[model samples]
Target: MHPAPSVIFFTVFSGIGFGLLVFLGLDTFYVTGWTAFVFFAIAYLCAVGGLIASTFHLGHPERAMKAFTQWRSSWLSREGVCAVVALVLMGIYGAGVVFLQVHWAILGHLGALFSLLTVFTTSMIYTQLTTIPRWNSWLTPLMFMSFSLAGGALLSGNVGSATVLILVAALIQIVLWLRGDGALARSGTTLATATGLGHIGDVRAFEPPHTGTNYLLKEFAYVVGRKHSTKLRIISIVLFAVIPVALLVFAPFSHLLAALAVVSHVAGAFATRWLFFAEAEHVVGLYYGKR
Candidate 1:
């Protein structure tokens, strides 16, 4: 599948934002009072900002309202609705934490549930795309959920716990990507299936679909060499997951290191996420002249 930078930023940035909200809600649940209100506010802002940034990817931003019309069948529509609901609930949750103070527990629980729902909605956006085999996995949602938790923990300044969780999530994502790649390499199934050809026999594209790249090719035909992808995977694991875990576990507690680890994880995760999109063999690519 082709990786849209806007979509990638949307997922990563919004995941972090929503993740932070989930953590803040959790903090309210266990730690009490309005101390976590500021964090919740930050979480809400990030979530909104990420959502807005994603709009830049649309060819017709004016038609964005049409997205909500297909919520019955479209995961993208559902994601939009879910995001709005999550934001609204977060607002109410924040209000309760600030003013009501009495229903923090109730609102916190609701926020956590919505956070999980938000992750599910995000995953569905990919998983429902039968055209993208790499994303059609139960692991996709888990990866999203794990990353959300991992990011939330990191942003919350609980480096030790976040590091452990992020590593676990990163390992899972790595395994899933490897499995998807192997499937693509073996059957030629990816490109074939994407083009609606079910046979296992050899297939190749001889003529180009267009003189210039179209939206589909630009968005889905992205390719990266296997060797480079492998190197990036290793780097991502180390920089985003393993090393951060080590630093959080062993290094002297310093805000700088914690902050750096977050930066590294975000950058590394973006790379990993890009690889996820690039390495994916879209069924559409077969029709577009890729073997």
Candidate 2:
């Protein structure tokens, strides 16, 4: 819940990258030659760059390779496997489309499926954490997928579809916030429950866990003030949804305007992702009496 910049970038950019791959794999645009090359380049850059960024968040980046072996049990491991499979499939498909000008329909469709699966696995990594009630919801996956698809639409130059999907993503974001606001309380977790002392009596911390901050406090117990959160929510919605939709629907269509919309959307994504981690109420916070 520390809102590490690397993780945020990984989720946002990789989601967008995979989303773009979905559209490309489906042959949404008849891109060929240099145009296809540019599209694939952007997609690969975002996807691969994000994966690389994620390594920096690891305590031992070199050990990241071990994550792939836990695919049967760990969502994180599943994500790694899916990402590799999706990238390889998409790479082959992209090469054919960009250089050979051949649309390998089967390969493209499979790549798209794996790409989507990769995003799902990424979301599950968060959603599976019951310790964080705010993220332990089905809506988390929906939110991720919606944003990815919406961003993909924007990048693919489908202005009409992008407007609608972006609007939907905004609505989902609003709903997620609303639901997450009470998720902690609704989870029935408290100092009593956390310490298994509810049967004894009312439980309260008599003293601090320590005189100074520690790793748990720095990581899982990070907090954001309510007023600041509200302001950021507004900013995120405006940049992610309002401006993009307004420009796409009302402003005269132009490549520059579309690019601006993409930029605004990605910025908004960063804000939303920051809030996602910062606002999470980890059950460990109850141990510190900080939630």
Candidate 3:
């Protein structure tokens, strides 16, 4: 799968936004007009911004609305629907907190549920893809969920929550990478199986499919070589997990460092998200000899 910048920005930015909304709904901190303003701004910027960015991936951005009708079977559609529902609920909830300074307990819980569901649906968009074995695991969704919660905890300045969630998310990410390293090798999908040529004899492409690149090669045959993957993975872990968690632990000594932790984590999230797309093995690539 291609790792378009728009999609990466959408996932990391909106993820943090929705995560913040989840914590806000829990009444995890004091709700003041100032706090409400800051939190809502962050949430909407990421959530709505990410949603808008997603359209760029479409050939016809104007027709993206058609996706809304396929919620029954499409994770992408479900993600859009859940996002809209959560945003609307959060909007109303924001109004009460920012204006009246009163908490609508029920609305808050509903908003949080939908917000988390939105993240889950986003993860499912990748997890449902059978061709990408690494992403096909349950750990994919868990990774997304953990990142959201951890980011939310950091943004809220809740050291206790951020510490625990970041550690868990970090650990999960490490395991994801460790396991994902072998996903391609264990896939069992070979040129023979793909073309159902196993019974006849060993199947191998004697020559290139075509002399020139086509849509399949450009879109599905993306290959982030093994050596590059190793370097990116190391960078991702340091920025996404190690640095932020460590900074948060020491943040009590210096609020400045706490702020830096969040900034670094967000930056690291971008790198990791990029790997999420780059590392995926699209089965169509097998036809292109990418596998």
Candidate 4:
């Protein structure tokens, strides 16, 4: 995948927003009045902003609303539906807390369920892509959900829980990278198999598919150097998990320190998300002898 910045921002920020809603729905923060308003405002900003960002990737952004009608057959549609439902439920739940200081336990729980579902659907958008073996794994959804929960916990001020979730998410991140590295090969998808010419003889492209670049090459066949990938992985893990955990455990707890941790984690998330798309080897690239 080309890893457009819009998609990366959408996944990371929207995941965090939904994660925060999960906690709010569960009454984990027990906030009220102006405090509750602030929390909900941040959540909505990230969630809605990320959703809006995704529209830029569409060739016809104006037609995006039609996606919601295909929920039965498209993960993208399901994600849109789930996001709208979650936002509606959360909005109602948030209103009660911000205005009346009342905790509508049922609405909160429902909102949380839908919010988590939205994240799951978002992950499925990539996970369902058989063309990208790296993302077509159970670990994809797990990684997405874990990071969401971890980010939500950090933002929700659940230090103890955030520390544990971050550690778990980090472990998952490492495993996802390891597994993804061999996914294409493990799937038995090679140039020979792709063209169904294995029985005839050993097949190899004698010449380039075309002289110049095309959409496939620019979008699905983008490549990253191994050395650069390694460096970015290390940087992502450090920012995403290590520094935040270290600060939380070793340093005296303070608001300043918490803010730093949040910043570091979000930065790390961005790096990892970038790598997620950049490193993906779409099977379509095999036709171009690129993957």
lDDT of each: 0.76, 0.93, 0.86, 0.94
In model 4, the runs with Cα more than 4 Å from the true position are none
> Which residue runs does candidate 1 get wrong by more than 4 Å?
28-37, 99-103, 185-203, 209-212, 224-227
TM-score of each: 0.87, 0.98, 0.95, 0.98
- lDDT for residue 67 in candidate 3, whole number 0-100: 82
| Global local distance difference test of model 2 | 0.93
Candidate 4 local lDDT, residue 148: 93
Q: Which candidate would rank higher by TM-score, 1 or 4?
A: 4
RMSD of 4: 1.0
Tell me the tens digit of each residue's lDDT in model 3 across 137-253. Answer: 899999999999999989877788988998898888889988987886688877888889889998877677679988877777777555588788788878978898877775464
Pitting candidate 3 against candidate 4, the one with the higher TM-score is 4
Model 4, 181-240: lDDT tens digits are 999999889999989998999887667777999998899988955459999999999999
Candidate 1 structure quality by residue, lDDT tens digits, 108-155: 667777876787788888776656677777888888888888988888
What lDDT is reached at residue 245 by model 3?
A: 81
Which pairs clash (backbone N, Cα, C closer than 3 Å) in model 4? Answer: none
Cα lDDT tens digits for candidate 2, 138-163 = 99999999999999999999888898
Overall local distance difference test of candidate 3 = 0.86
Error of 3 at 12 (Å): 0.9
